[model samples]
Every structure is written in structure tokens, then in C-alpha cells.
Target: MRILLLGAEGLLGTTVWATAEADPRVTELVAAGRADVDVTSRDAVRRAVLDVRPDAVINTAALMPADLCDETPEAAYAINALGPRWVSQACAGIDAVPVYVSTDFVFDGAGSQPYPPDGYPRPVQTYGITKLAGEHETRLGSERYLVTRSACLFGPPPRSPRARRCFVDRVAEKASAGGDLKVVDNVITSPTYTRDLATTILDLLYHKAPSGTYHAVNQGVASWYELCRTALDRLGLPAQVTPIQEQNYTTAPRPLHTPLTGTLPDGVRRIRRPWQAALDDYLVQYPALRTDERDVA
Candidate 1:
């Protein structure tokens, strides 16, 4: 299947491109980063989608960090909300399925249980709120669409220089250096591997999964503390990791618990590995995580 991928240099987008390259099913992929088409411009998005004329368009571009989104809400809304609207409209014109890569932030983490894809969203911060709006725009704008929400991504560092470093890498580096880390314990999230999420998206589309939301996160959940500790332990990196109940605040409010779970459409199979297992696969990619392994004598 021919595909058009935006944010091709990003964490998830980069993995998606690489995975598509390896998958025989992905016959052709036109990878487009911001320079190729700025989604904020309706005309640009329309032009790119129509010109590429792919069977499907996967949009992974966004103003990522929560704090950045708060500092620049207008840009956040423009890219996160309005961009999807334009892409969806363009996809509708070409009868191509539009797929939006979304986040767990869309839901307020009040509930204890893992949330289903169709669960009611009550975003607490601007990032979440804007993404939720984007979700609506995608669904409403397109005849057929897919919104896949995942969280706590860890994989190869994003190709874009501006992208934030993966959390796992940060923790791994600090721990290897014996840094004392105070990680939030109660703030739960689905730890997703970019490769896994990308694979899920592709498999879903290949199966012709019906238009709707899909929770694209790994099977299990972990708080920042547990996540870090697990990675450190697996990598044989020694450090002090303390689990605190709350994180010191700055600008944005975070949901304490927003682990995602979902119902799969019939006959559509997805890679639903647990986050811990997925992490093992990810650690293999960044062998530096095991740099201390030889030093463990």
C-alpha cells in the first residue's frame, strides 16, 4: 500500500518510516517532514496529500512537550488541532484514510483502571485539550479515519534536532553516572515503544480496521519511577531511584494515571506486547544502555 507520512523525522514517525521500509506490505512510502509540507497551512497540507495521492496518510507531526504547548498555545492549537482538520479534509477529497497519531494526555487521569480507546476524554492541560480537539477534527473531517493514542514513547532518538530525548535514555544515562533520581511514583502511563506503535498502526490499516480510535500503547503501565527503575535494572545500570508521590510542578498539570487499553476490531491483529517486554526490545537497539554490562565484573 502507498503511504504518505508526515513528521518523518520524529520519534514515532522515524520508526514508522523504517518499519514501512522493511514491510513488504508498504509498497511505497512518501515520507514528508515539516520542510516538505507545513500542516498549519491548509493549502500546503491539501497540496501535499493530493499530489502524493497515497492510499493513506499518517500524520505524526505535533508540538510535543506539554510545557512548550502551554508557552505557545496558539501554535499548539494550530498544529495539533487545525492541522488535523486540514489533513482530514484533504484525505476526504482523495478518498484516502487519514490516520492521526495522538496521545494519552487527551484523558484526565482521574480513573484508576486503564482507559479504553472510546473512553470519555477530559484533558487537564493545554496539550491534552488541543490534541482532543485534533481528534475531533480528524473524525469529523474525514469519511474514514484512524486515531491511535499512545504514551511514554521510548526508542531511537528522534531524527529532528529539536525533538526531546527519550525518557529511558535520560534515566539510563543519569543512572549509569550514579545520579540520585527522584521520580514520580503515582503518575502512571502506558510505556510505548515507537516501533511497536508504528507496527500496530500499519497492521491495523492492512487489516482494513474500521474507522475509529485505537489505543496504540503497550499492554502494561508504569509510573515514571517504576519505568526508570525497570530500565536501569535491565541495563545493569546502578543508581539510586526514589519514588515520590508527586512531581515538583512548573506550568502544566499532569494526569496522575492515564494508562490506555482498547478493544480491537474483529479479525484485526496487533502487536500487544507488555511495555516491559517492549522495553527489552528497545534496549537492544540502544546498546549503550548495556555499556555498564562489561564493567559489572
Candidate 2:
């Protein structure tokens, strides 16, 4: 399979690129970051997809800075919403399957139970709204598109500092610095591993999973505070991390509960491990983090 991975330099995209490149089924991988493909431009998307003529086009691109999206709605819509639309159109034109990675943020977080794939979305922020738009457009435009929603991803150590800004990374930084950490207990969700997600996506392609939305998150639920504690415990760090309410945080309004639920579509299950187990695997992959233990020992 020839695959064109959009946003191939991002936190999750990097893992997807590596996974595809390593797969024997994948004959070609055309990975591109924002510098290579401007998703906001419809013409650029058409040209790129046409040139690649891939069997699958996986999009991991988004204006994911939630706070920035709140401040710049137009920019967020152009990239997050319209970008998917363009990709969908291009994929439809060439009869290629398009896989779009969405977020759990599409829900408002009011439900006490985990959200199913078909659950109605009521996003609370500009970021979530735009992403939801992307989802709807992709679904409406392409018949062979797979829209997968997930949350709280951690993965292989980033190649650069600019790429290292996920929840786990932040916790590691504070723990390494011997600084206090304040995590919001009010916000809860399933945190996933990027490598796991990437592998699952490839499984979906191999199985020719039906074109529909799917929920793929790590097993188990956790508040931000619990996630932090798990990381600290894994790293054997003694950091003062306080649990606080969401209102105390500077980040824009967050969903109270964004855990995704439901079995993967038939023939599309790559990972079903607990989130903590996945975190442990991620930390093991980073030699720097592993050495931190010896230094402390």
C-alpha cells in the first residue's frame, strides 16, 4: 500500500510515519509536514494527493494548539475544518481511502459514561468545534474514509524540543526539575500511546475496515492528576503534584470527561492495553528517560 501521511512531523504523525515505513505491506510512504504541504490550500492538497496517488491518505494535521485556536478561530477553521474537506475531495476524486484522526474534545464532557463512536458531539471550544467540522466534512465527502477519534497521546521521544509538549512530557519535565506540579482533577480521559495508535491505523487499512467513525483510546480512565501520578511513579520521581479543579488552570475550557468507548470496527484492533502500560513502554523507548533512573540510583 502506498500511504501519504499528512503532518508527518507531529507528535503522533512521527510514529505513524515510522510504523508505515516499517510495514512490509506499505510499498511507499510520502510523509510531509506543514513545510512540505500547506493543508489550508485546496489546490495544494489536490496537487499533492494526485501526485502521490496513494492507496491511503492518513491525515494527522491540525492547528492543535487549543489555546491558540481559542484566540484565532478563523485560522483554526481554515486548517482544522476546511483542510479535511479538501483532503476528502481529493481522495474522492482519486478513489483513495482517507483516514482522518479526530479528537475526543468534540464532546462537551458532560456525560458520566464513556462516549461511543456514534455519540452526538457538542464541543465546548473553538478547537473542538473546528475538529468536529473536519469530521463531518470528511464523512460527507468520502465513502472510503476512516474517521478515528482518540485522546491524550504520549509516544517516542521527540526529535526536537519543539515536538515535546504532551501531558507526559510536561510531567516529566517538572519531575526532572524537582518542581511542583498542579494537575486538574476535574478533567478525565483515556490517554493513548502514539505507537499504539499508529499500529491500529495500519490494522484498519489491512482489514479494509468499514468507512465510519471509530473510538480508539487506551483502556482505563484517569483524571489529569492520576495521569501525572502514574508518570511520576513510573519514573521513580519524587515531585510535589497537587490535584486541583479545572477552573484553576490557565488552559482554555476543557471537557470534564472525554474518554472514548466501544470496540473497534470488526478486524481493526491493534492495541487494547492499559494506558499506564503504554506509558511504561513509551518511557522505555527514550534512552534519556531510562538513564534518568541510573543517574538517580
Query: Lowest summed-lDDT stretch of 10 residues in model 2?
Result: 288-297
Candidate 1 per-residue lDDT over residues 37-143, each given as its tens digit: 89899999999998999889999999978989999999999999999999999999989999999999999999999999878899999999999999999999997
The residue pairs found clashing in candidate 2 are none
User: For residues 58-126, what per-residue lDDT tens digits would candidate 2 score against the true structure?
Assistant: 998888668889999999999899999999999999999888899999999998999999898999999
Question: CA lDDT, every prediction?
Answer: 0.88, 0.87
Q: What lDDT score is found at residue 45 in candidate 1?
A: 93
Best by lDDT: 1
> Can you tell me which runs of candidate 2 are displaced by over 4 Å?
158-164, 291-297
Clashing pairs in 1: none
